[model samples]
Target: MHWSDRYVGQDYVADEADCAVLACSVAREVLGLDIQLPGERRPGPFGRGALIQQHQADFARRVDEPADAQPVLLIARGRAQHIGVMCRLVGEWWVLHADEGAGSVLRQRLREMARQGYQVEGYYQWL
Candidate 1:
C-alpha cells in the first residue's frame, strides 16, 4: 500500500492538517526523518520560504530528481507556500498534498499541478 493513501482525502485545516503538516508526516513515516514546520505561517511574504529553508538546513538534502518518497516544495502565484510528498507512479511523479481549495488531500501529476499554476521549486529528501 502507498504510504500516502492514509493522507489522501484528509480534510485540510490551516495550521493543522495542511500541506506542511501532511508533508512532514509523510517524510517522517516513509523516510523515517522528522522535518519540522510551524503550524501558523510566519509574518511577511517570505514566511513560508523561510520555514522551508530552516527545515532544509536542519535535515533535508536537496535533490535534483524526484523519487518514490521525496518532498517537493511548490510555488503558487510566485509564493513559496506549499509542500507535498511525491511518489512515482508508472514513471510519473505525483504529489500528495492537501489544500483549502481542493478541500482535502489529493494526488496530482506534477505537470498537472504546474499547469494549475504551481511552480515546483525543488525536491528534497530528508536526511
Candidate 2:
C-alpha cells in the first residue's frame, strides 16, 4: 500500500498531525512497526529545537541505500503546501505523499516541490 493512500482525505485538524506525522504514521504501518508518537526530546537541525528535522535525518539514515527501497514522500505546509515522492535517478517514481486536504494522494513532481523549499524532514519505508 502506498503511503499516499493511507491518510488521504483524513482530517488532521485538532490533531496537530502535521505532514511529518502523516508520513511517519504511514511508514510505520507499512513497515509493520508499532505506531507511536515519535519522540520529541531530541535536538533539531537548527538550534531552535525542531524534532521533525531530527526524525527525518534518522529515518533517512536508516534507509539511505537499501537496494530495494521505495521512494519516500516529501510534504510541506504553509504558502506552498504540497506532497511529492523521491525517486532513483532513473526509476519508477514512488507515491511518497499527497496533500490530504486535497482529498487525493496524487503523484506529484518532486523537482517542483523541492524548488519551492518544502522541508522533506522524514520518510516512510517498509521494514
Candidate 3:
C-alpha cells in the first residue's frame, strides 16, 4: 500500500493535520525524509519564513519536474503558505493535501489548485 493512504481522509487540524504537519509526516513516513518547519516547537504557524527558507536551502533540492511522493508548495495570496504531496492518480499528477475549509485531506489536480488562488510554486525532494 502507498504510504499516503494513512492520511487520505484525515480531518484537517491546525498544527496537527494541517498542510505542513501532514506534508512533513508524509516526507518522513513515505520517503524516509525528515524536516523541521516553523511553529512546530512554539506557538506559531508552520513555514513562517526564515525557517522553511533555510530548511529548503540546507536540505531540499528543487526540481523542474515533480515526481511521486514529492512535496509540492501552493502559493496563497502572495506568499507560499500551503503544502501537499504529489501523487500519481488516474495517470495524472494530483496533490494530496489537507484543507481546512474542506476540514479534511483533499486530493486535487495540479491545475485546479492554481485556479483556486493557490499557485504551484514547485516541488521538492528533502535530503
lDDT (tens digit, per residue) of candidate 2 on 1-127: 5435545555543225544455456546644554454555332223213444434444444355322223353434432222234443345443445444554444444445565455554444533
Estimate the TM-score for candidate 2.
0.45
Q: Between the candidate structures 1 and 2, which one is better when assessed by lDDT?
A: 1
Clashing pairs in 3: none
TM-score each candidate: 0.84, 0.45, 0.81
Instruction: Encode model 1's per-residue lDDT on 26-126: one tens digit a residue.
Output: 87788787766545576443886777666565666779998777788888768877788888876788998886677899999888987777888888777
Query: Ten consecutive residues with minimal summed lDDT in candidate 3?
Result: 41-50
- Give the clash count for each candidate: 0, 1, 0
Q: Give the clashing residue pairs of candidate 1, or none.
A: none
Model 2: CA > 4 A from native: 1-3, 35-49, 53-91, 98-107, 119-127
Residue ranges of candidate 3 with Cα displaced over 4 Å: 1-3, 38-51
Residue 93 accuracy (lDDT) in model 1:
81
Candidate 3, residue 85: how far the Cα is off, in Å? 0.8
**Residue 33 C-alpha lDDT in model 3:** 77
Please report, in order, the local distance difference test score of every candidate based on alpha carbons: 0.78, 0.43, 0.75
lDDT, residue 12, candidate 1: 90
Superposed Cα deviation of residue 120, candidate 3 (Å): 0.9
